[model samples]
Target chain A: MPDSEAAVRKRIRGLLAQLYGGDSFVETVSDGISLRQAGVSSHALVALLVAMEDEFGFEWDDDVRPEALRSIESLAGHVLSLQE
Target chain B: MSGYANLARLDLAYREDRRIRVRDGVELYYETRGEGTPITLLNAFFLPSPSWRVFTEELAGSYRVVGYDLCNHGKSSHVGPEPTWEEHAADLIALLDGLEIESTHLIAASTSTILARDVALRHPDRVRGVVLAGPVFGPRGMRRQRQVQRAWLRTLESHGIAGLYEHMYPEVFSAEMNEAIGTPGFLGFREAFSALSTVDDLVNGLNRAMEDVGDPAVLAGVERPALVVVGDDDFLMGPTAARELAALFPHGRAEIMPKAGHVPFVDDAEGFQAIVRKFFEEVDARA
Candidate 1:
């Protein structure tokens, strides 16, 4: 079964925390804030994509599209889309 | 007097990881594994010490493999002032001294070779051997160098390393080698590299890389054994550049790694490690 949007967003924040080595900055950001505003670079996005692959059990080819990486909500939407 | 040639198997046991503050209050992140004569590895421009994991793990069985992130790069403090190759060389020396390693072999990738060349010449007694993988220290003329740098800087600014990778990988790696992107090893590398903070360092590192093309007259004086290895399909800097570099060293030799890219170590770790093992044994032979 697919995780609810809230659950998916929480997992992403969790992965971001791990990737940033517990920096916690991403977790502190407002839900509506985009990842780029959260200071996640394009390099970090690739890392996050790979981490999501492992955590969510799906493989994504090419890079994560810009729109999908814009905000936490967008990311959760992307994950849900992948599941569907 | 390390009987390097006699070792039939690498132990791959024991490991040490440390963060030491060297000269000028710069903190460096370093890790070591296996045992025997030490071999220090300097990573590529953008990636950090973790990029050396797979390659180092393979060699740790035979010798002590030390991998370190240059200051401002990895777990190391990015809180330092502007950097110079000379200062980077001194940092390497201080870090080695901190590790209690008097002299050891060196394996460097891409722009990291600048400091490797610096320290090797300034303190040759401290470097037992050197292997410069896909070195960019050649005299490629200012215009061409500037052109390449501008393109990369623009790409990095606009799209980041992911975009930069997409734009450059085709030029850097062969089609077959590029296919390794989805491998577990490469995935781990991508994760590690993403932890880094900003792109300013990449620009600085590349700028510093193009600033100094080592003088051939001085490189010829390097008495220690040196090897320049580039991938056969490395369009960026192929065998010609490698041969040119090798010709400058009194004891230097060059080889082209089959079916690889600008960074052959990442493309074919087995072939890269074999080349390094042989060169290391040769370096030990003279000792």
Candidate 2:
């Protein structure tokens, strides 16, 4: 897992970008942007979680709070907490 | 009479979006277009009527295509008996009666195939032909469907509707088909699904079983020309189960569509529409 939150956001952004068709706009999105604004559909949450789990090499405990999935920063925090 | 009276005001010649009350007083949202032989489309349990938007618009150029949301899904009245598809079948027959359709071709996907089959058997003279896609019926098909239905309820309990859709995606559409439709297209479908779905509604709908779940034995009595179609990649109920379903009907035939999954229309729209159009035409010709 990434040691710092910055690295975690970068990784999360890249993964989300891929789900969004790898468009450059997704790459440049600010960390604070809402998931809906970032083109993270409610439908893609599971796919994103799967990708993140595979990329980070950790299994989700099957109980992620919906708020933690609100933004890149929030998701990074969630992932880093789990790493601890 | 009220149901028939409601239909009297609507302009069925072109296009109309409205809910016609069934004999039981439950309203079902429906859209009808075109002017030829009537064909009613029954979507899978998870999908709303608009999932058939593209196909409905195209088919309306020829056949009088009627697409509707089943009770407890989409814009239809959710007050009906949940999971008892005998009511769903009755609602369908009532819809046809309200529309003044004496006989029509029936196209149903997944679990809805059971309802269509029930209608064809009970009202043999009313069905011109039948198309069953990714049918979760028959002896083996029903068994497999029960197992998967349990998984769906559990998935919904832990991960919500998004997880449920994800679990169903692979079983419903192949990788190639998913890529072909693109992310935006798939998202649109999911958005529509999420808009009309809830955990309780889905659980109730998944619990859906009818009087005929174990009764493919009765299908031999159906003399209607039946076409069973399955996506080769459908993990849930593949070609074998589909063929089993077709064999039950006296005039039935089963065919496989390549690079598709459970939801053949979404997976291979062009091929699905082509095969069905041909089958309906053949049935109409023999009439």
Candidate 3:
């Protein structure tokens, strides 16, 4: 991964940990892991989005297709797209 | 009859019926009256269709006014394991599908405003415009509000109907209105309040559903034309919050009703109805 992609992934993993209270982000994302499978419930997903918005200063679009958030990598990619 | 003059001549007609098997397979209870463009009204927290009587009556002649009890409130069945805003939105979607409504305006008050925004964001095709009154995204400073809401819920669970009334009546409306309206309205309000007054009901479901609500960031994304109404004297949600809420909608405008409290329709039915009618007409004309 490029340095910027790696930093975004690190930030996402930290957010996931803060929201879900687990330390498996690195292990789980060895090949990337679905957020739902990583135990991110809808409630936690909302909290995560709130955290992301606070960190990035933008609103996360709720209307976006849920399938787009399949994994940490995908989630980071979505966030990066928003940043651009 | 002119819309404003027709206020006192209000006549209310409503139907209570069930329709089965939408594509989503959710059974819904829907009530409707009058004809023209359809307008769906979503009730505030713990309020039912009867509370919407004045607003509905005033608008019926000019538009199709439909309002339904969310699953756990009013006459609707609490057959579900739990209630969430998404489920509430889905129920609305199903109701529209069952009624064969292609597009309609949505007016929501209090907590239902949360659901209305969700529907507009997720199913924009079905929604032509929206009006959110006394909007509550999530309770600010969740810790304390959650505790109070939970305590109220527990009081209701243990005290049955009467206990719930004691805890909820003061917070819902002014103490003076409760005294003036006497036992009948108080009893009705109690019944409506208790229907969803439980900690589990709110914390696990309603609160979660409310999570997506009231954020200006979320409201800004809603491209539909919107009107926000707030009461100047509203004790629960004030004018400042209403102004903040209005700023969220890209096409949002706000009106403040003088001397009105939380439930503006109940507090000033005539003025409230006129504002609502005018807003709907303006949105329709623009469209």
Candidate 4:
């Protein structure tokens, strides 16, 4: 991943933390951790995507999978792939 | 009876209570009125089924109107843990099966547009046409989604549900109408908002289901005629989004409600009803 995309990952983690209410769950948002399992509500997922759009200034195309929002790493990879 | 008492009695007389059991034994609150072709009314996320009473009555004058509370909203059975959009669509189809209705037209507002679109796309044989007001579209560049998320997050975090209502009022109604109509209804809204004050589960679940259905591809294959209506002043879903939504469907068109906001039905009921009535009439004629 490019340094810019990696930077986005870190920012998204922080944003998710704020969105999910800064619980202990935020500390464990590893790439493999499922966002749903990590207690990221659907609303948070939307907020995260919205936050990503604002931060990256790019919209997701129709071809993108909704499941990409499953994990932090998965979402980052998807966003980064879009950037590429 | 006094004049006020007579009016109340008349309203009570017109209301016909009905319910249908969907799949998984979820009981849904629904009402049917008027006659002729059927039209199903989908509930807005926050607004319960009864909130559509005025529009349902207006449309019922000429057509058969069916309005129902989705599972866990209003008086509907709350049986699910966390149902997905697909499951919600199943419930709707099951409702139709229970009612023994073959096919019907659909009208939805705000996030409920997702439900209507999903059902119509999956079961074209079961849906005649669709009318979406303040229609929510799939991810269109994520700007609008982000805007919605930010506004909602701010409310949930700082003010809770009460604060959320204040934040949502302007988005749902025009500034002038907010004072004229919304203010007068605040007391009743207070009771409703209070009930929703701690309803985090319902809110989050519904939001998640809506997100699942936000894929634009879902509507790409919808062949039914669609009318996308948006108020000129609706801050939540603007004209651009409405037009984009219309473009997604093969036979879709967009209409603007001048000087109205998110809930145009409340601000200008007659105007909104006229537009919808005309749209359905045209759809029928084309058929």
Candidate 5:
């Protein structure tokens, strides 16, 4: 991963920790953690998305398919792609 | 009885009561009146069927008007731990099934419009027509308004029922209406608001559910004829959102009532009723 991508990922990790309660499992970004495993229910995911939109100054496009949000890696990638 | 007393007696006599059990064993509270073609009325956020008192009375003479309090509101049991929009829709469908209502028209306002749309999308076979008034979809500019509402709800939670009632009066009713309606009726409104204030679980669960609401596209597929009504003075849901919602319906038209606020039914009942009666007549003609 490029230096910028890594930085973005690190920032996301920090946000996840703050929002979902920081823990060792969340810190390890190299090992992917699913939203479910990270204790994010469907309701919490929506809240997190809203918070992220407010925090990052970008709206998460709902036009995209739900499959895009299946895993944490995918969600991170989606966020990163939006940043680009 | 005197003419006024007789009129009051007639009003009191006009009510229908029934019990309906849904698939999940949830018993829905329902009341029906009038004769031809059932017209189901859904209440807005936290308000119950009684909120539709004037609206129901106006239409009950012509149509089989049915109004029911959703679960967690009014006399209905809050048996389910979480009250999602889907659950509300299910309760509506269950009420229909129990009443043996094969098909009917629907009229919903504000938050209840969410369930109305869901029903139209999910159970198209049952919905003959739909009328949505002051539909409250959190569009882009409404963020600040939503924040205000959230803050008000928080105040309700922290300060107890009396405090909530004091704070909610201005927001719930127009100044003119409040003055004209008098204190006793206003106190009744306060009691309703207080009842809603106490249902914290419903509020929290509904807030969470609203966050991930898919999109208007879910409502895009509804083929039934629909009428979208909004008050010109409804600052909460501006005219633009009303237009957008109207466009979503396959067979839909928009009507903006002049000089009316959020609850146009309350502000101008005669005008609102005329619009609804006319729309249902058109739908009936088409059907």
Candidate 6:
């Protein structure tokens, strides 16, 4: 079954925390929080993509726009779109 | 010595040769200097380990510099044919194990970037950080590789190392260095690498090696702190690819050396050293 949008967001938040630092940054990645504003390095964004691929079993296609990696919400949306 | 047979042997005589046995019975030749954070110096396509003698001399004061000739290059023993980047990574693992080094920073240039990246992705835990100069990935900017290979092979087969130098000189060095190509260092580089043409194993490996790089997934998976340095005027890898490569790493950034070419360390050694030293300091601070 497909995970609900909220669950995907939560998982993404958890992955970001585990891969990057801790819960402090995880709490800030809400819909309004831009990844840049959240202090995400380009490295962290790539790591997030890799971690998501490991969790979701779907590799990111090259056609995906750079904007897709702009924020957690956008990333979650991209992941959900892939599932669908 | 087959490669050095016709060339002046004075410069080549200064380098001390040592060997280590990797898996599959391949012996790789390497050199080391100083004692600090272990930093492995990887060579460019045509140049051997001693090509890095000048750069290593400076870097050795601050870091444990391990400069090695990959299998089939320089004095390194060739197992059979050119090994894949994966196999090269395996050889590196064995080399590190043989040296009793668990983890180290990779300071690589040109095609060695692919080797470094393969090792970093395959064994992230064993890499502390990466510093790449004129870095090239396989899939990106690979369209020109075939042309390059054809040119290299033609140069090797036809005119010998002198012609090969004239063929590649413009692409490898800055315009300033090109103007003064007769300098001792530049002359030595031409003679030394030209001598490399006589080594049968180093021939015919370019196309195969270039094929193993440029995987987007693997690039994205490298989680180490990486500093990608490129010559501002480098047309081979270019600054755009350098920037893109840097962005692919989780903790990555790029620097462009003004008036430099593919071999920035040779073109602007002082500036390159400053940049690398600063990056290493930052990496050490983070550690």
Tens-place lDDT digits, model 4, residues B1-287:
22111111111111445788786567888888888898999876576665566555668888888888777776777775656777778888998888788888999987788788888888888988899888766326334754675667667677666666666766766765655432223322332444532456446644564465366766778989998888888886777777887888899998988877876676667677788999999988888
- What docking class should model 1 receive? incorrect
RMSD of 4: 17.4
Clashes of each: 3, 0, 0, 0, 0, 4
**Which of the numbered candidates is closest to the native, going by highest lDDT?**
2
Ranking by TM-score: 1, 2, 6, 4, 5, 3
A best-first ranking of the candidates according to their lDDT comes to 2, 1, 6, 4, 5, 3
Residues A17-61 of candidate 4: C-alpha lDDT, one tens digit per residue:
776678466787677777655555433454566667777677644
DockQ of each: 0.08, 0.06, 0.01, 0.01, 0.01, 0.01
| Per-model lDDT | 0.72, 0.73, 0.64, 0.69, 0.65, 0.72
Residue range with the least summed lDDT across 10 consecutive positions in model 2 chain B: B3-12
**Candidate 2 lDDT over residue span B167-237, tens digit each:** 77656677775655444334433433454577877888887742345577887988899999888887766
Model 1 per-residue lDDT tens digits across residues A1-84: 889989998998888888788945775766678665566654466567778889988876556554565677887898899888
Models 1 onward score TM values of: 0.74, 0.73, 0.64, 0.68, 0.66, 0.69
Q: Which ten residues in a row have the lowest lDDT in candidate 1 chain B?
A: B1-10
Q: What is the Å distance of residue B256 in model 3 from its true position?
A: 1.3
Candidate 2 TM-score to native:
0.73
First chain TM-score in every candidate? Answer: 0.82, 0.81, 0.74, 0.78, 0.66, 0.89
Q: In candidate 3, what are the lDDT values of residues B164-254, reduced to their tens digit?
A: 5566556655444544544433433333344433544443343453345244567767888878777776655677767766776788888
Minimal lDDT window, size 10, model 6 chain A = A37-46
User: Residue B104 in candidate 6 has what lDDT?
Assistant: 91
Which parts of model 6 have CA positions greater than 4 angstroms off? Answer: A1-84, B1-11, B138-141, B182-189, B197-199
TM-score of 6: 0.69
Scanning candidate 1 chain A in windows of ten residues, the lowest lDDT window is A61-70
Q: Model 1 chain B, TM?
A: 0.85
lDDT of 6 by residue, B143-196 (tens): 565577568767767866566676677777778655543332333344345455
| Cand. 5 Cα-lDDT | 0.65
Top-scoring candidate (TM-score): 1
